[model samples]
Target: MPAPSSTASAFLPVVPRLRSLRNSITLAANPIPVLDTYLNTYGDTIVVYLGGIRRTVLTRDPGLVQHMLQKNHRNYPKSDLSHGVARYLGHGLLTSEGSYWLRQRRLIQPGFHRQRIAGLVALMQTEINDCLEPLERQLAKQGGFVEVAVHALMITTAFRIIARSVFSNSLAERQLHRMAELLTAIQAFYVRTVRQPYLRPWQHARGQFRRHDQLAAELRDIVRGYIRQRKEASGPVPDDLLQMLLDARYEDNGEPMTEEQVLDEAAILLVAGHETSANALSWMWYLLAQHPEVVTKLRTEITQVLGDRPATFADLPGLGYSLQVIQETMRLYPPAWILDRVAQEDDTYNGLALPKGTLISGYLYGIHHSAKLWDEPEAFRPERFGPDQVRQQVPYAYIPFGGGPRLCIGNQFALTEMQLVLLEMLRRFDVEWVEQPAIDLMPLITLRPRQEIKVRFRRHKA
Candidate 1:
């Protein structure tokens, strides 16, 4: 279907002031409940007022999502709130907008090209095996279920792929840990600041912003050190992500990215790529733990595809069911749960007036779970993403990586990396949750599990 027409108004039924205040409070603490309550009560779209002054039009309409994200995308720049992220990540792809974003995107896009990323599959597999092998050996020694949190495992693996594969030896463990510290610190600050804007003065008074700036500077210096090393190295330069970034030039002036821009992009990828992929993969394992039948199906697919071998680049296509499982997991627990943009000018969409500076939150979580969009939308049904079913999917209905021009550049890399990691995990172990499901979301820079998910891994039997 085409994008939503401008003739249609945003948010079908506006939430009244009194109710909006109550809902707004709930949203600051836990948005999932608030979004669900209102989305069901107000149809696909709803107008919400935060603190009785800030109006956020939350919409799950696939058409409208596409309309703003793609059709008339220029009219809606990413919300100024990303400055919270910029405080840590600088003007990277995720936080940058306007001509700077465009220029930086062009410079960075080549690093994630399919061919380049394809070469990294071997690197990804090596890292996955490195992470899993020791765990498997320990599992064998234990001879039964051994509880281990998959979130940490996934996070570490993702970090290895990005840090080791791309930046290589330049990012030392100390610096990597520092990177994590900065990301966590900034995210906590950002989530708190955005959720409770009135608390900004409190945060500033508490030196939260100062600490964020300090950590951000440290992280930038770490990235810059790596970049400098690559440039100064006398040895033959490897054709990895860092090299690609160093080599990339602006299409117009043919100028290479400045060292500052390199640092920004590196910091962005280090955090965004690592966290999102890890979160998605961890959630997949969690879902599998809850759904043994789905795990069995995945096992069957993995067995049929790999036989006596490990999954490789060529094997990914045949691992269709495995990919479906990942796709379905993302649908249920999209890491980037919500997105917002500010209207650049006064406009009308289907007769709904969008005043300039209006913040529009494309409620991805709500849209993914909308009852009108799917049969049994709440159910964990991987078959829904099968070839035929995929054709029937409403555009913007499944945007784990977003869509249109602003679609995540590393989508291919993440998917392919996940394909290998998931297959390897399944083929090697029969996983079951040691603890209960990780259902509650800790909404921050990304949607994370409220509690870590513990899973017991035992060697798979013939």
Candidate 2:
């Protein structure tokens, strides 16, 4: 609770000693356990010093989180420290701040309009179904228990859908494959760089930075080439995401995005949509398999809504329980398990003041799992998100997609994709956990299962 360099009895309890190499090691390996310990032992406002210089306060208090992320959002600009992706992906929506971010958000916001995203539901379903052909073939050839890696399957399908939606189907398999490889590499390196900053010298010695730059250049070229193709497509510009970006003009001066800006946005779109949706669906499948009762309820709702047909946008509104299932799934395993915002100026909250440059993270996992907020916090109870039930929960307490102005722009798109995929999954097969895969949480850029989550996809009875 104590802000760094402040008076000891300054209206809040300090994380005594404020430094612990033991907890630091635990934080690097998996921050969840350490955070859980902090929540239990130190209570909400837990502070830690990194390398004996930077101060990071982990806050799980919902009202204070509301004040920080929403009430006084302007005072909490994103820290450059968390922009590790910019080194690999450049300054895009997720990394940029101030006027640049605002400009981009305004210009790009139209692309995700409800009608536009709703129109893509058919396109989304097509990509998922086409990708599943191979799976269906495998299910036939390999029999009941397909034992497929769920994360890989979901990512592949979601990636293709996003690529088509963004680039207007311009990316060839070769181009897509190369882009995928570079993105995966960049993500791995970015996560490592952020988690282990002291290893930068060692990383540089191994040419990690040089190699990442090269890969980034190639990815940028692929995206820029697609933008050029869209611009020169001859006909009236196709009504796709690429066309939208190309068409976006600043309200202040009517200036269009530069080619580099276009590439940055395109790259972020692909990276953000692919990884986030995949993580959500993978965990949903895992949770559904583990909780058969929820699955049964979900399946019942699916049957009542679609009645043996493939799901569509029209079906989503009626799929209330289905939506709740996703909501609850996210509550348990939010894709972005943590978010950071550096204090732009000294600010006080909940009787504690933070110094400028103090990195503040609303420990999302800790907040979502707080016993003070949720009943049976560790249990997977989808009904907790039922309309009436969720109304009682605080606004920032269940921020699966985040809150405030920085709330995910692709929120609608992700939900639509997830809804369609979940419908397809539930309708097509009887899901079961393969090999009793022990749940090992991987707190990477997204929350992912540590090991390959193999699932048995038996054909459901007709």
Candidate 3:
């Protein structure tokens, strides 16, 4: 990695630095804000030195992003940073590489096909209604405030949806809650390990790593138990992800997946399945709350399209404005805000040379907020996503779900789920923000709102 540029050195005083041993621990504890500060001051792209490792951040140029993610992907492979995460996730699609990743990707790609996802839209609607019914009753009677983090609620809902879609009875509240807790613990540990790699050796002795391992084991056991029960039963195969995976056979070998592979893939699906969607929903709600006109317009569109009925798969296409709202929200606060890759071999982009093993972090936040690419980049405007308007933007200027061969496979599923949930919630209730609360970016495995998003939902009169 190259040394910090003269510009970086010039801004050293403004950058937050760890002062003491205690402060260093705290800095390692949460460097998200510090990173955001650097991006804010350095204008999209900047090099930062963190714990002796130098990282080059590219945020302003979308063509650069496209080159790295799609055009020149072979040159850059998934970074070693993902290795620690794979310990818990297993060699699932998200973590696997080389032939393993290729095989998994090909096998699972069909499960997310448009036709397959369309079949699950009804299931998603059922789950959304199940979740919203109680909230609707609460809004009708007492007009209580929804103080929970929107991201957390969205994840909870998405998890149940994905769980039910995978294992018919996997939506049990207790099971979902347990899984959520375990996933949270695992992610927390992952954040700590990534920010401070030096502490990894002591993580096990300190009980933190042990706790994560235990949670991962417990999760695997839960999945294994589900698989075992499904196998024992002589009943009909359900039309869910689990069944799909069960039916899936390797094209070359015609061999069924091993039990361990099944469990690992299922776990990966559960984690990646909910986190990104939930974060998108949470950010969408936040954006909607900020822009009342947009909210009103969305409500009007939903009312006209659904006409007091729940949103169905067919209703989705007509919810174009709602889609735009979600798109704009993702633009402003993308959940998968950063993507990283380590050079597998020496590579060059434009004219700059990248050596082997150099870690490159793509800043989606900076790319979305870059004034050079976006007009009035800081403001929330859904019109920017209008069909013609979107055409005007650069190819990679607006990649919320990422791009390229390894582009998120669940993008279509997530978009449909978010659209359905947003329409359902907005149709039944009015979400009004309490106040513009302190906005802090907690960039972990995904970008998350630091504080709880408190809002009041008033049930719409019939």
Candidate 4:
């Protein structure tokens, strides 16, 4: 209930700490609805106490998000809310800040370039095909229809694609599964600690923190072993992300990243590369199952462009509707749903005052769903992203991959991978809705379905 550092905040509405405290339990369970309720009640921008512990400004204002993320980004580096992940994930691009982050970004940028990702298309498709083999087998045995837990399937499929993309054949299947498990365990626990800051002492007393730290160490060891294998390998270097990181040399001194640095970046890539795409692809299937009309339109575009042939890197650009579906899915269930930034200095947007050291939580989910920004904001309409429609919207209102100078480094890579997965899966199978309980959102580090999304996939009849 104490006043903020600056009077500029007075211009904004305040959700009392007590109210946020009362809602903290609900917020911890699923923050999207709790946050949406707050935004819906108190304009687009307001101040609320996070976890009833820290007073912070929460805004779904596209202008404010753009201002913090793009316009004057230097004054608004990622807050501890982001850095806190480094305890488990390491200080890679996602958790790092300032000049070091810039350097790493510059060094790793080329690896994700259009030309580079284009080259990886075959690798991605091969992995995608491999992932679908089991489903194909199930359909064959079950009279051409098989029920699948789509979220679990997408998680496995996405992790393989990213792992192969990063380590190529260096990691064995067992090792890959182990790494995935460790990452998931660490991330899930980290989210619990963050959402319930009051439980830190209890978690620590119960040795949960120590156990997760050990898990993180094991993850690092797995990655480090692979990096060392690449370093000690005797043959031609495999064309993979690990190689790309190995070959990258800083512009100034022309020195490659150290072993520890490589481990940090590689771990970050594995964590970042898989989770968002997995969640997006999972949500994409969920949405498509409910809306067969949308799926039919998608098939039309695919057949027109690809016929019975598989889509290659060149064929992807022509598949516009597929990308729009992915875009719209992200709009509905953005993986990186909310972002946190802390002000390093006093600043103001329009008439609102922002004192130095202000903590701002840019609610991207709200911005994407704001009635003021979109007509029928809750509807799933891929056409909204069509060329003309996209230009009609406000900037930063549709930032599924985030925006500004620090835009997701792997945005193009994620889009290409998601598009390829969608095309390949639809081309091979018919995704049908399977009756189940209504799916609820579980907004952890990423937005996921609270329960398994069950869907039936039948072999495509040409």
Best by lDDT: 4
lDDT for position 126 in model 2: 80
Could you tell me which residue pairs clash in candidate 4? 8-353
Model 3, span 1-462: residue lDDT tens:
223344312322222223223244554645555555656665555555555343444445687678878999888778877766888878788888878888989998999998989988878888888877667666557665544457667877888887887787644578778988889889888887777767878986788877788889998888888888787878677778887887789999998889888888888888888777787788787877777899888878877888888877877888899899889989988888888887788776665556676677787887887788898998999999999998898889999988999999888888899888888887777777767656676677887777767666776664
lDDT, ranked from best to worst: 4, 2, 1, 3
How much lDDT does each candidate structure score? 0.81, 0.81, 0.77, 0.91
TM-score of 1: 0.94
**For model 3, what is the alpha-carbon lDDT of residue 390?**
87
Query: Tens-digit lDDT track for model 1 on 1-462?
Result: 112323234434667656766666667877788777777776677777665556678888888788889988999889877656887788889888889888888778878887888788877888899899779778768777678878889988988888876776566778777777777777777787777776778889999888878877887887888899889989777767878888998899998888888788878888778888889988888888888999888877877778858887877888899889989989998988888888898877776677787788998888888888878888999999999999999889999888878898889999998888888887778888665644678766677887888888888885
Score residue 82 of candidate 2 by CA lDDT: 61
Q: Lowest lDDT 10-mer window, candidate 4?
A: 1-10
Cα lDDT tens digits, model 4, 348-417, are 9987889998999999889889898989999999999999999999998899988887899999999999
Q: Model 2: what TM-score?
A: 0.95
Model 1 residue 25 CA deviation in Å:
4.6
On lDDT, who's better, 2 or 3? Answer: 2
lDDT of 2 by residue, 1-462 (tens): 433336432444445443444455566667678677766876786675543334567788887778778899999877766686787788889889988898899889988999999878877888888988887998888786577788889878888888888876667888887887888888888877776666789999999899989989988988988888777778665567888888889999999989888888888998988888888888888888788898889888877878888987877989999888888889989998988888888888765777776787787888889999999999999899788898898779899887888999999999989988888887888888666747788888888777767777889875
For residue 306, what is the lDDT in candidate 1? 82
Per-candidate alpha-carbon RMSD to the true structure: 3.6, 2.2, 3.5, 1.5
Clashes of each: 5, 0, 0, 1
